[model samples]
Target: MNAAGFNPSERHPDLEMLDGYWSDGNQARLPINGVPECFIDLDPSHGTLTLSVPADGPEPDLARFRSIELATYTDGGDVWWEIRIQVDDSLHEAYSLLTRIADLVQLENQAVAVATYQALEAYRLLLASRGGMSDEQQTGLYGELLVLEHLLRTLSPELIVPAWMGPAKEEHDVALPDVHYEVKSTKGEHRRHMISGTQQLEPLRGVPLWLVSIQLTPTTPDAGRSLIDLVAVVRGLSGHRLPRVNELLVSAGWRDRDADLYDAHLTLRSKPRAYLIDLSFPALTDARIAQVVPSASLVRDVSYRVDVTQLDFAGPPSPMDAFVEIPEEKTE
Candidate 1:
């Protein structure tokens, strides 16, 4: 039975005209007249409309909806975008959404990005919607994700997601078995980051704490990847821990359905720099404040910024080995 409440044999006679031509891996160009190419993609499960944006113009926002999926790919000499319905019961709603999107993108006066924005706005209006991440959150999440990706290479799949503690409101962004890391991101020329409280840089008992700083600069779309694209990369590399990672993402206030709302792309200003936070490291911890003030208990919510551009204390060459016990190399 289909969503229309009819079995295949009971399908209307007029609709039967599409059976031989559209079924069995076939497609037909839609009557939509525009600069972009549009087609009806027929498949075993349901019908799909593939909208090719024609040239190397602005890419479509890859927003994941409950009933549909939007994606793009490069074909031969041109870039192509497609939207497909995923739910059988919501076919009517999906068709209406896609057609409206088609109409928006096909207008001669609208820029591709503007068209895409309008289409995504339509999607949010019709589906379950949530507010998007702030600029600060986006940058911070990007840095944490880069560190998470780095950890994925060194830690076991089961241990990776559990180690990412940022979403859980832990003192550190990443708490591995051997070391804890405070990840920070900034767009300024100096290696400076805002610290919320003393606990952020405080080292754990008998454990080492390191701070990883990532600098990001705005760049053209052609040269950079959006936050959503980075998220997709992390998901692809998660292997068996995909579900756990997704849960962490949700706890961090990110949902796939809201991916379209973030379009700003950025590139790395420089490779990430890691510094070991030890006795000489420049930071105002509880112990440091206690040394100067007789009543350190009276102070609260200590927030400040630190510039580490000239920090001499550096981590292991391979940051993955930070705080992890490594046997000393034998010399003859």
Candidate 2:
């Protein structure tokens, strides 16, 4: 509570446990490393992240982190700033949302020189459409989660890219510095999958991209597992980073409480097949499209379904770390 007056606009959830929030005040104080206990507060009235910046202040280039706009409020000798954004209603989810931003600030404090807050996953949650998802979208999201579970189980936690769970507009589903992954889930038996854009499967010169295809068939209530089960699996495997993964899941249109709404049960049709996108892989690139199509503009919206039932699994670039290693140049 500010000595002068703590008339914060109240709207944020999960503040009942913090005293002074019930009747007199709308803000709750949270203590974190390096940042002052006075540095963090939530305006439950407006669902905003009310923070007091140190003398140095926040990152100057705020464009990278979208949706959240910084606002100022004058208090005696204190320069207070607030991170304001629209929030989803669930208490659990909103708490997860606040912690994500708080964690970023803590990380920024630890890394003094580097700006880790650029990984503004909260914005992804904010910008992620509240639009209803189709049955196919739910199934596909489940498929991606299963694969992520597999990767976490198989590879070092440091190797998996955090941004893979960000906006789906990325060229590949999951990416690392030297390698990337495009995950596709299908109910079709022929290993057929839809490619969203020309760039989805387009191979890069030095980077190795893998296309993982999982075939799932709907199962009876007694037989198959639901997405809720997979959500629990991801949460268990995610450990300390659950907030980050949850942010991604929420951004992908998943609500923990609404897991039952996604009640379709599915069983794997076969082992997931992964194909390395080398020069020999089949796909259309910008250069190739420009040569064949009459106008470059006409091919901009190109999308198609490719049947990979017969395509050979090129395997990983290296057998050492199958999940995330760059392909080594072939010897002549």
Candidate 3:
């Protein structure tokens, strides 16, 4: 069975062991193998993933990860972060949620805090997509993730997620300490992209803006990476910062539950190229429109297409790997 089809309630051999502990007055515990200080507790009525921490340790911000009613209780001078889920009807979702939290808790020393952040981030992303992502949306997110993968080479996931602004509907797709980027992907042969509005191409006061064009070629699933695969790669690289990565993915309309719907695979036509959005770049900004047509102030929702196939733009063929920054250089 696939991951979603695996039923822990019926299949886990240790379920009966927890039942014995629960039948008595004691809280039944099953230590989650390989994860430090983590345990599982279950009865026929409910299930819970528990993380035991020092009473004086940093507490998880419950408000951060709010989907499940996580509780913190002190027993015998130790604090426990209890993640409970009703397994009777929502066993699959409960298992998925607990495992995701355990995955984060496994990686960090601050178990409860990290798990809380991860759970919160997962729900935030999953909730953003009320339904499955569209084919076009998946293609767009794929291109952005490619850029994210490149950034992760030198930058940490913590630095990259905040710089990723596309999901927040910011003017640019990425904003590093020194520069900002607008990412675009197209199946067409030429370097063409649809600009959403006059403000999309507008750069900040002093920060340089760049237009990153990615060419994607549709291919068989075996020949290229599907959206789901690309997301997994990025998440694997995120380490303890997986929750922040989920925050961006959800903002971009990706939901893990709908992974099967995003099987369309796309191969990169070429390395993503970043063209500096200088005065010579082909674009229609509000300032330019007002200068050319004095009555342009009356226009709203202005959008157009620009093809840079023949433009003499200054940039390397593969521009992503060259961009890097230190955390101190970032702006608020």
Candidate 4:
């Protein structure tokens, strides 16, 4: 009964028995592409997908993850949900990606798919370290992700390695073989931005390291968008093109279920400025830190903020290939 034939590199035991469920015409569990314990049961006749859990399983609030279609069932008073959906190949790809992410996190909740979405976003933002991140840091991370997504849309499509994935504390936020991009984002009115570590903005000999500044206004009831709004619109539109950005969002402390928790709205008030961080740029480099330290001990934990507000640029920031351009800055 292997009807829809999708070949995995290797088959999981659960998937091996997937077709057997068809006989019941109800549903059965199979841990397919994701975690060994994550079972997704499908009812072809009804076109539904479900992840059942025992009464004690952690149940995450999913009221905000709008794409989910929920159905409840009780087996001897133990509650479960069929978070079903009729998915096409593209949507199915998204599901598979989420499933793999959930597997990696070893999720223990009934909202496995939703949690997977959050995990993927977390991975993208590079917050794999244990413990929770602050809301302000999360907001800042979201801003970084928005800049990444905006860059992808503006630049040519190519596989890009996120800054967090590089060897610990890489200089730039994003690396693309030839050039590097360091993304800085702020919510404040002033052009103040923080550069972590002296090495971050310090340029290498040959390769170009460009600094991108993104600023957003606060969210408002009448206008502005939340992280959820950005994710929903992009996922709904881009389909397969979204998984990459989704990872960044998750890394930035985004969870599909917690979308509503982020009540803040953000409007980009100005065009993201891209400048070449060369010798002329204002920053605390390793060379400079050594001279300033009393013992000249390596200041590995150095982080400083620079105000580029009134710096009179001879012309404009250095040219970058396909960096995002602001159509119009919204002023509320």
All candidates: TM-score: 0.57, 0.57, 0.57, 0.52
lDDT per residue for candidate 4 within 24-112, as digits (tens), equals 66755666443334456666675455554332335544444434455677867656555554432223432343344445445353344
User: Which parts of model 1 have CA positions greater than 4 angstroms off?
Assistant: 1-130, 317-332
| Candidate-wise lDDT, in order | 0.69, 0.62, 0.68, 0.55
Q: For candidate 3, lDDT tens digit of each residue in 28-61?
A: 5555655365666655434443434333346665
Any residue pairs clashing in model 2, and if so which? 10-44, 10-45, 10-46, 11-44, 11-45, 11-46, 12-44
State, as a TM-score between 0 and 1, how close model 3 is to the true structure: 0.57
Off by more than 4 A, model 2: 1-132, 161-168, 317-332
Structural RMSD, model 1:
12.8
Q: Over the stretch 1-332, how does candidate 1's per-residue lDDT look in tens digits?
A: 32323231221122344455445545554445565655445453445534445543575555545545666777786676666654233433444455555565665456555665665565565454335667888899988988787777766668878888998888999887778889899988988999988899998876788888888998989999888888988898799889989988877778676787667889889766777888888888898999999899899999999998776535443556543233346699
Query: How close is each model in CA RMSD to the real structure?
Result: 12.8, 15.9, 16.6, 11.9
Which candidate number maximizes lDDT? 1
Candidate scoring better on lDDT of 1 and 4: 1
**Residue runs of model 3 more than 4 Å from their true location after superposition:** 1-131, 316-332
Candidate 1: C-alpha lDDT: 0.69
Model 4 accuracy (lDDT, Cα) = 0.55
